[model samples]
Target: MSNTTRSKPNKPDARAKLLDAAFSLIRAKGYCATSVDDLCREAGVTKGAFFHHFKSKEELGVAAANHWSEMTGIFFATAPYHDHQDPLERVLGYLDFRRAILQGEVREFTCLVGTMVQETYDTAPAIRAACEASISGHAAKIEADIAEALARAGMKPDWSAKSLALHSQAVLQGAFILAKANGGAEIAGESIDHLKRYICLLFNRS
Candidate 1:
């Protein structure tokens, strides 16, 4: 007896595939343009599988934002910037890391939640809130380093560390938009360079 038929490989979980699809498609095409059909196609799943995991497209968007946060949280937490003993050095290293990651296409390096929230902020409250949390939470991580640096430098600026942290995100999000408009990452790297310079001036570092 010849046994020639091979067993099929296991497929990824439908929900996880859908999340991965959202990350790619939304960044490439933006949120309002990417429909359920697009996500299902990209994920290699059926419409039924999509609907089974998500009650609505907006619901899926919210989930995607949270998933992005969780994934990037692990990424930034493990980044080598934290290895610096001096807090100012750590902050500058973080900016350097951001600059270094601007490879490939604009869509490949841009933030997923930032792309979604820009389009959905007015229409989808749940998605907007989720995106806000993701951006703010990451900013808070930077704020810790900024605050520590401020203390070490004994510089009591009128502005709060939290405000400066949020401003950094504003610059990054704007840089992504500019990259989309101009079709490259050079502009984004320029913005990061300016940000790093500003941090140095604040910390009185050369």
Candidate 2:
């Protein structure tokens, strides 16, 4: 009888795989409920592999938030919204882009850092800090455009650019919660539209 040889399983990129698994599981089950075992099982890796990369679950949470930030930073930086010549148009386009991307499952479109912070802000300081950095870092990108648009319009606003920037994130995180509760994107889309309308009114954009 001819001997049949089985193919060896491919080795996964343990760190990246663990991060991906954590991002997905945390988004679905919340940070506290998703254990290291769950992440390892989802990642198809061993406990040794998980611990080799991350010393503790908290360490993994921090890394996951940073990974999400880096990934989304690249995604938005290369997005078409940046092509607009007018800063206000760019800002509006960014909102429109965000609304447009809300087509998939709630977990697919929702913010990882936003979800994580809401659950762990009080209990997990390191993870909360990571989440804050990711959210604030993203807000800073839009804040620059807002500042430019304000300067171009020669308008002095009552609110600082930083507040408005953070406000946008607040709206988005709230919208995600509504979408999750309502079990659809309709309410979330409406909320984003309202945000768009408010921004338009603020900038006096017709």
Candidate 3:
């Protein structure tokens, strides 16, 4: 009798698995280093499945950015930081929450879109645009709180809420890079602490 080999069954959510795998692998190895085969193996799916969902690696990069935005948007929306009645408190709480969540491996905590944009921004316009949208979309979610905080404090700042919101992301992405260089989360936490202090000073809460 001939030996029989059994193939693993396909996951009902293969697309989501691919996105999750891409997010993790890309964060660890970066866009240029990760390949279609890496994603397929990581996702436990075949190249055929991957191509069926995403036309190419570049297409997957764009989808991954959008996936990152959706997953993280839901995460922050349901986070406890929003429970504060005061908008300024909510804003500060959001930063505090960010700090609190920094206990993990660098790849685990770092932003996927941030990593991808740094690598592919010059080479891939579609991926870059998707990353920009993901980052800016997340920023816009907090812009309302920043605007309300500024108004409640009776402060006339030179910067718009959109700019300040973007600034916070800039600080975070920079912190992630520094942490990656330094090989620890302490520097990243300190960066966030400084950001919190800047926010306090801005709002005259310090």
Candidate 4:
């Protein structure tokens, strides 16, 4: 006989459900509009489960930021950096990934940290600090990539990797903002094109 019963409420990972719900809602509806009830409803979990995992919505936001950082870090880890023999091509490949994101093929250009940074950077010190730290960590990773490219080319960097990384992050973040503001991908793609030119100018490679 076939028996059918309702699935367990605490099925799968409750914390993962909560995080997924929070990330989706925040991405879809923005951070300010997402609430505990919204997350619980979206995750099909109970309030007890939500509160059991996260003490507050702000805590969940921080957790979501960390999750995003981890997920994207993994993406960059295996991205097409080694696809081309030229070190400059590797750098260009990295920037091209950013362009794809702007084009909304793999992931939207919307960055969780960038979203939060725009809203609370000046007013909310804790949230701003979290965003700042995440951005800094990402910048460091890009710096390492830039250093690798320089080393592979047998050329010493006139500028520090950290500075180049910071610039790259700034350009990418700005492109995201323009994309969101313009309500289209044109601005983002164009901005990145300019950024690509800037990168070529800096490295003296095209």
Candidate 5:
């Protein structure tokens, strides 16, 4: 074998860095507040490199939203949902995960979709649509998990899975908003605990 190894191309490296930087910055700041210059700086790449990878900031925002959705969807799907035998326990575990994420204090209290919705919904329709789509996708994943729990318990719901899914999204997103407004994660967790109770009641009723 030759002593020298082949070097990876710069294009993929630049693209990955840009995406990672966009993800971090958008999560820290809202999409509208994060400029292309900021993204380039965060990525440690020049504006020319950033433009080479993403034609426009809107395009980069959409890609970041997609990346966020894919990553978080996998996390929620595999997280301790089936740990308990009872459906109610499983539901509470999901809520507990959300609470832990809130209280961890390592990450900022920002959901990509929520950030985009608040920042770019009126200005950028495509970016807004991407965020909305990501929200719906998360809801669907949660709904499927809930449906699985219902099946395991030999129970059925009067409402469709989609309704339950949307409700879950609303609860969590509302909790985030409350946390932001209240200047702490405690209020958000408390508000979400009520949602936990609601889910338990729903599970018992089914």
Candidate 6:
């Protein structure tokens, strides 16, 4: 036998390819419209490979949401916003970070889980629940900083950190929809701008 290099195929590699394809295709086409065939085509994997990894398309959706959460969790954890010593500054810095990241195509900048949940909320309960977990999980991260900011500021207001954090996600998901409908990123940026302002006003910052 000739000495030659060959790659050892791994199940995770194929599963990851399918999940990555789902992230892109679902963002572009939404959940109901992005069929399994499209995922296979985009992922450059066979139907057998697809089915070998995922029991069904819905199962893939659930995995995609979880994977998206994992990927983004790391992305935000090490972000520059966390560098600020002051908790409130960190919160504002998080807003700035969000605004700075709106510098790509609509699908590229938008949330994959958000894109999926909108269309699947009623028709696909599993996907919807997975999406809710992903969104709420990310919001929980923000809520931690917000809660710290609230405690440090000694602000005893009616509103809660959890609510504000989830509201931030709502604005972002809605901004993505506006970006899709208007066929540009400007609207999304403007929406983030407004969100930033709202947060600043909430904390009584100029």
Instruction: Show how many residue pairs clash in every candidate, following the order shown.
Output: 0, 0, 0, 0, 0, 0
Candidate 5 minimal-lDDT segment of 10 residues:
1-10
> Which should have the higher lDDT, number 5 or number 6?
6
Q: Clashes in model 5: which pairs? A: none
Candidate number with greatest lDDT: 1
For model 4, what is the error of residue 8's alpha carbon versus the real structure, in angstroms, after optimal superposition? Answer: 18
Candidate-wise lDDT, in order: 0.87, 0.87, 0.85, 0.72, 0.74, 0.84
Q: 10-49, model 2: which lDDT tens digit per residue?
A: 7548888888787678877889899999999998999999
lDDT of 5 at 166: 88
Clash list (residue pairs), candidate 3: none
Badly placed stretches (over 4 Å) of model 4 are 1-11, 103-107, 151-158
Estimate, for each residue in 26-142, the C-alpha lDDT of model 4 and write its tens digit. 655677877789999998999999889988888888887777677666666677765766656767887887676554421244677777777767766777787788889988877
- Taking all chains together, each candidate's TM-score versus the true structure is 0.94, 0.93, 0.93, 0.83, 0.82, 0.92
lDDT tens digits, residues 15-51, model 3?
8788878877887899999999999999899999998
Quickly count the clashes in candidate 3. Answer: 0
Candidate 2 residue 179 Cα shift, in angstroms, is 0.9
Candidate number with the higher TM-score (2 or 4): 2
lDDT of 6 by residue, 99-183 (tens): 7777657777788888888888998899999999999998998899999988988897899999999999999888888989998
Candidates sorted by TM-score, descending order? 1, 2, 3, 6, 4, 5
Q: Which ten-residue region of model 2 has the weakest summed lDDT?
A: 1-10
Better of 2 and 5 by TM-score: 2
Worst ten in a row by lDDT for model 1: 1-10
